[model samples]
Target: MAEKAPKEMSFLDHLEELRWLLVRSTIAILVLASLSFFISDFIFEKILFGPKDPNFITYRFFCSISQSFGLEDVEICDAKMPFIIQNTSMGGQVSFLIWTCITAGFIIGFPYILWEVWKFISPALYAKEKKYAGAFVIVSSLLFFLGVLFGYFIITPLSVYFFGSFNASPEIVNEFNLESYTSMIKTSTIACGLLFELPIIIYFLTKMGLVSASFLRKYRKYALVIVLIVAAIITPPDVISQIIVTIPIMALYEISILISAVVGKKELMESTSK
Candidate 1:
């Protein structure tokens, strides 16, 4: 009997498909970003700069908790931050606007971007795998946005409080540049968002047989240490701040282990059936 030729797609066909995906994703990002630009003032004032104020919701919540515990020395009880933000560059405002729009675009377009990525990889997966598209997108996007919120509401504030209040001498004052402050917020938010996709990454790796539950379990302790180190890097030096940041990440790691085990079982079942 004659051997059947392997199915193949032309290079140009692949390129055309990829081009449309990019075009659609870019359009979605721009539309969302344009909407975000209209609310940029609110985003900056109410959300971005909220951590800098003592009366902010997070600060108020922490203050109430402290009062309930009878802790009189809580840092959240401070009247105001002692720092001033300034812009020194000539085109700093314009540059800031452009980058801020792009950042907003990425955040809003994250789901669509994931969809495009899924489409690219879906051709290589089995029918059973394709069924997970919606769950993967929804769960991954939720985790990412949750991470961004945690970074903004918790990690950023703690770091700002620690670094802003730190001084070598009583006479020294802290004056931060607007660009620098915004950069810190943006980096922290996006970094955490990406970090929270660990379980999804592990799921795919497990599906591909590149990783297993045993491997993850064996290295679990090391992962915990790394998570704590990362938390320390992103948060204030205080143990409370580090613990708060590490908890969710530890939870995510445990979830990743469960996901890997599920994937491993599914692969085993499929193989046995074949």
Candidate 2:
């Protein structure tokens, strides 16, 4: 049996389709957001403010690792951080609450969002491509959550530690604004989450003939430099922190290259058989 081409939908038809996708996605986000709002206290105190505390799980885990290696004076093992978070604006708290809910909505609703996106694109894909739909969603979701965890547990703590301890002079105090602190945490978490979609991105790009494994390999060094630059931008200026952040990103890039190769080979074999 011959496969049929996707129907040519009008501009308005496409718009209507997109509108429904958005509507469904929005509903999902709102439902999740409403639930999260009810538990906002726990989210704010335990998850959002976690990195700022000396007893945060990441800090304790690293502290234990350091102790095992006889590096007992590791900075993360400290009893307390020498900084404070405060709100300078009158509406800062209110704004923070609203934005936090929106962010939580997006994160919690990400799987549904992916489903909608896949639905919109699936009609254009080959039968073989459609077969991998479940795998695509599972792998992408896992990578995003892992990236979020990395950002929350690793990047956030390192940033807090560096910024909190930094003092140009004894007269200066490190009283960070609440808005700024939340913004840092949000950016780190969300940015890493998106960045971790590299493999999925490469897979699609390979399918579209927009990227290839050889090209990625050829530019590997340049990609490493770009990854390091990104790490430096998102993390503290310290070499150790930058290296820690860059390592996972570099690993993701290698994985992306492998995915691209697999996708490219599969597509090529299918075309040849046809």
- Specify the highest-lDDT model's number: 2
CA lDDT scores, all candidates in order: 0.81, 0.83
Off by over 4 Å in 2: 1-6, 229-244
List, residue by residue over 135-228, the lDDT tens digit for candidate 1. Answer: 8889989989998987788778866776777788999899998899999989988888998999999988997889999998999999899988
> Lowest summed lDDT over 10 consecutive residues: which window, candidate 2?
233-242
Reference-based TM-score of each model? 0.87, 0.89
Residue pairs in candidate 1 whose N, alpha carbon or C atoms collide under 3 angstroms: none
lDDT of 2 by residue, 1-274 (tens): 2363467677888789899999999989888888888889998999889888888887787667667768766666774678999999999998888789889999978978998888877777766567778887888899999989888888888777777877899999889999999999999898889989989888888989999999999999998998788777655454555777788989999999999999899888878888
Q: Model 1: runs farther than 4 Å from truth?
A: 1-7, 10-16, 66-70, 233-238
